[model samples]
Target: MKLYGIKNCDTVRKAKKWLEANNIEHTFVDFRVDGLTQADIEAWLEHTSWETLFNKRSTSFRGLTDEQKADIDQAKAIALMLEHPTLIKRPVLAMADGVMVGFKEADYQGALL
Candidate 1:
């Protein structure tokens, strides 16, 4: 399994702790350091909608100009996410089964456990 997120993100930390406590082995890929590719984002999009993967509440998203946020299609969203990986949300878990965006203990329990 692989977990992708910014190293400093609180949600990512929580997810990591949960995984460790549950004895789920996972490799963590810090977006800030390891970087993300277009293909990576595309693969994630296959599992979840762009809206689900996109972190509109993030500072990076909020910092965008109104023009940049207007009528965002999939391509536009992917472009923005590629430019600002933090905009892709936290603790995106990817495994052979599928990709999951964000961290919810209950959801993880169902999907992972």
Candidate 2:
């Protein structure tokens, strides 16, 4: 499994901790350090919707101009995420089964464990 997220993000930290506690072997790719490619984002988009991948609650999204936030289509959302990876949700887990965005203990247990 490959976990993609920013190293400093609280949610990412929590996810990593949970995985370690469960003894789940996985590779963590820090978006800030490793950087994200368009291909990576596109691959995620295939499994999840733009709405699911896009994090509207993030500071990066909130910092965007009103016009930028308005009428967000798939392309617009993808572009925003490309420019600011933090705009994507935390700890996007890519597993053999599929891609999961964000972390929920129950969901992780059900899906991963």
Best by TM-score: 1
lDDT of 1: 0.91
lDDT of 2 at 32: 85
What residue runs in model 1 are displaced by over 4 Å at the alpha carbon?
none
Candidate 2 residue lDDT tens string, 59-86: 9988999999999999999998989899
Model 1 lowest lDDT segment of ten: 39-48
Residue 44 lDDT (model 2): 86
Query: What local lDDT score does residue 26 receive in model 1, on the 0 to 100 scale?
Result: 97
Q: Pick the candidate with the highest lDDT.
A: 2
Please, what are the lDDT tens digits per residue for candidate 1 over residues 1-113? 99999888999999999999999999999989999999988888888899999889999999999999999999999999989888888989998878988889999999988
Query: Clashing pairs in model 1?
Result: none
For each candidate, give its TM-score against the true structure.
Answer: 0.95, 0.95
